[model samples]
Target: MTTDAETAVFEEHRPVLMGVAYRMLGRVADAEDVVQEAWLRWSAADRAGVREPPAYLVRITTRLAIDRLRQVKARGEAYVGPWLPEPYATDFGDTVPDTEERAVLADSVSLAVLVVLESLSPLERAVFVLREAFGYPYAEIATMLDRGEPAVRQLAGRARRHVDERRPRYDVDPAQRRDLTERFLAAAAEGDLAGLMDLLAPDVRLVGDSGGKAQAPLRILESADNVGRFLVAVGGKSVPDMSFRFLELNGGPAVLVLSGGMPDSVFQVDVSAGRISSVYVLRNPDKLRSLASA
Candidate 1:
């Protein structure tokens, strides 16, 4: 029974709601479900006196995401092999024009930061996402979480500290990252062990997430020697009707490997001090499903 005008209003803020939900849950399906639930609530609610639609929608999405995160934790499902956030395709296009704002959004959604966020409590993560990623004021966040301003501020501070201590520092220049990624890909595809080692930092670490459904390292592979050898070995083998496409994933360049036009895996790297520092390989088919159409 929702009017067209009201539906239009909800659609206008859908992107922001999706951003908040995805940042909170780190899973596309969960985030989408939370957003859909928010739509259901908005459609059925009394909207006559609602003054700020964006804030209201965001609040519903955030709360739902927090509840979903808590339920997921309670389930205690075991994830096989090392886990990484599902690669999120980020094409800001014309939506984010300000360089500083774009950088903030990208950093918040980066794989490294998301991995660090997984260690934070759901409440802390919610506060951090709202205050850091979206720049919501302490009072506004307090109202959203039904928490006092001081309590919200404390949560933000604690979450910020934890993230600062654990998050790996990577070069933010996209050009540098893109160049390094291209060279790394070339070296890896060519099975050039020396070239791969040269582009990798001495202490480079590679984390592969296969969810036990694909062939990937069960344990994290570390050091240039180990990582280089693994890549070389992997490259030496032939994938049937394999193809590669470059896309912007998680706010950075990623190589999507497809076998027979279906997503096989995604490879993204973090650059530090002009060298590849961390390599993230996502082979989880469930996680790659979204990228299949990209």
Candidate 2:
């Protein structure tokens, strides 16, 4: 038997759990499933003797997410192409009510960071998310993972170092990112190679996710010239007229444009020293399904 207060507590913690699962899994659908399962476990629990519902629910969600990550890892080995995180069509305001908060949230959720996260082992990823993203104390995190405090700290430190090395530093000013994105989009859409080069950094890399449903570079393309040429070649073809809608992505400005009346793709811009350092174009139709549904 449950009291009204207990039910309310569970509901209050749902978003936090969803956020945790989303960061851990890098896919909204999978995160939702994990959270749903957490709810089921919570509801089935004997509430009378239980205390600290928030921590209890978080433990359930974290464990379920780790198990799911193991399964996802095996699945990725046989995936069709370069795996990309699923995109969500969440309202920026709803997710991050504060303007400053939106930028931080967007940068954190960036596809590049999520991709880097994929490289981490399951425990490493969990430790990083719980500590870095959610600000969980090491003692609490250690208990959640059933590990000693020292071991948990080491795991989080290792994950942080790995991420710091691979992940580009992000600037989260929405207006600035939005402006840069616009310039990049306009340059690409018009097939202006020079303009594109001007906006792209010297070491710019372009990662495309087509999932074999559309044409994309099978591997990551390095160098500004190569990325520019590829963009020109692709843009020359007849592409659906897309409306560029800037949205908060991975704690930064991202474009979620609609083509043919569906969510076509997401573009993540990595800006460094006022130039776009990298551009990630996710065109995998399957990955875009959630964004479409949103």
Candidate 3:
């Protein structure tokens, strides 16, 4: 028999576990699976025998996430094109009861951080997430991973350095990001290559993922000129009646929908100092299935 207090504790910590799993695995579906497994372990525990419920649950969630990450890595190695993180339309106000905590969680869940996390190994990723993102102490992390303290420290250090090297400092204001996204969409919809060029950074790159199920740019295009040319071609080919709707994606603004009401693509805009740094286009039909289901 489960006590009311245990149930309350489970509800209290569910979001945190979800956040950790989401960051570690980069997929909402996988994260949900990890959390569900955590719940099973928690429910099966002998309440009188175990103590520190929150930590116990987190340990279970982290291990499960690490396992999932390994599986995802194998899939990515065989994947046809770029693999992007899953996007979620989070209503923070409704999901988080506390205003201050909600703000912190929202920042941690941003797309830039999640995308850069792709570079870390499964164990390194778990250690970094627990230490940096969740503020777990080295000793606690060691216990969770069943490793020595020195090993945990090494993993976290390597993970941190990798992230620092790959991801630029992201400090764009939300209002500015929204404005830039709107401008880009307007240019794209109108097939205004000149207008679009003005928004892209000099070294901007575009990566498209179609998973061989839909038409997409098979390879990554570097430099602003190539990206501009490709966008112009796509716009010219698209039907005149196509519409683009801006939605919250990976905690940033992104576009969805195309001509004849078909799901088109999901884009991640990297902004540096007010200009678009890069654009990641995810067109994989399997990846887009969630959007279709929604």
Candidate 4:
């Protein structure tokens, strides 16, 4: 292939590569870095020997992400509070028309799932991302990881079991989630404690990630009462100039609060049985910086 042809091939698969990397690492910056490294490697590779471009690119991105994830884990950076994945803008556009496939993608990247994935071994995470999120065959995954097919299968099984055991169940219907999310934001913004309580599940859990750079609960808040009151109290203390914009993020509707035209925080809810079962707040300034530019 000529230079333009090679570039076109890389660009065509960029989204899939990004999706794989992001799912593997759970941080946008790190995922992008991994993808860039994959591009460099791809561009320098002997293209004539590469018959399957998509698989080759995915393998490169996944390995790079595994390396990045290992480095991040080694850093031992203490999280200020509940650590949530950096909110990613997920717009499937016209490419993903299948409902079930989209749901799989969304659930795989949800905050709760990503948090659970953080506990997985790097190889396990890579297997899960490839087999679960992207539906790669065990043979293909084994080749990508340079491991035996049986070992890859085992890794996939273990990762799937772990994720299935920990990932919270939520309704996947976008319309239902959007409706509840809108009501959720309205209730919190108005300081309507009763309204907020009504929307929360009895055992609803709230996890706020602030990284100690902003005001947020330093511990997880559980139960409808506790989460509701905390939200109302925080709302009461919020400055008058705060504003919120509703947008689809991480495959669902989310509230983006802007303070003076800058991203201040993000609020997203997980609805189960038509009530909010979990609420995630991202207040870490480092995490919000990316959204500010969006």
Best by TM-score: 1
What are the C-alpha RMSDs, in order, of all predicted structures? Answer: 0.7, 2.4, 2.9, 1.2
Which tens-of-lDDT digit does each residue in 116-170 have in candidate 3? 8887898998998898777899999999999999999999999988887876565
lDDT ranking, best first: 1, 4, 2, 3
lDDT of each: 0.94, 0.81, 0.79, 0.91
**For model 1, how does the per-residue alpha-carbon lDDT over 1-294 read when each residue is reduced to its tens digit?**
899999999999998898999889889988999999999999988898789888899989999999999999899889999989988989999999999999999999999999999999999999999999999999999999999999999999999999999998889899999999999999999999999989999999999999999999999999999999999999998989999999999899999999999999999999999999999999999999999889
TM-score for candidate 4, please give it: 0.97
lDDT string for model 2 (67-160, tens) is 9999988786565557777764444557557665555455556777888998999999999888876778999999888999999989998999
- Specify the highest-lDDT model's number: 1
Clashes of each: 0, 8, 0, 0
- Give the Å shift of residue 6 in candidate 2: 3.7
Tell me the tens digit of each residue's lDDT in model 4 across 1-294: 349989999999999999999888878888889999998999889999999999999989988998898998899888877899999999887789998999988888888899999999999999999998889999999999999999999999999999999999988889999999999888998899999989999999999999999988889999999999999988887665788788878888899999898998999999999999999999998888779867
What TM-score does each of the candidates earn?
0.99, 0.90, 0.87, 0.97
Total backbone collisions, model 4? 0
Order the candidates by TM-score, highest first — what do you get?
1, 4, 2, 3
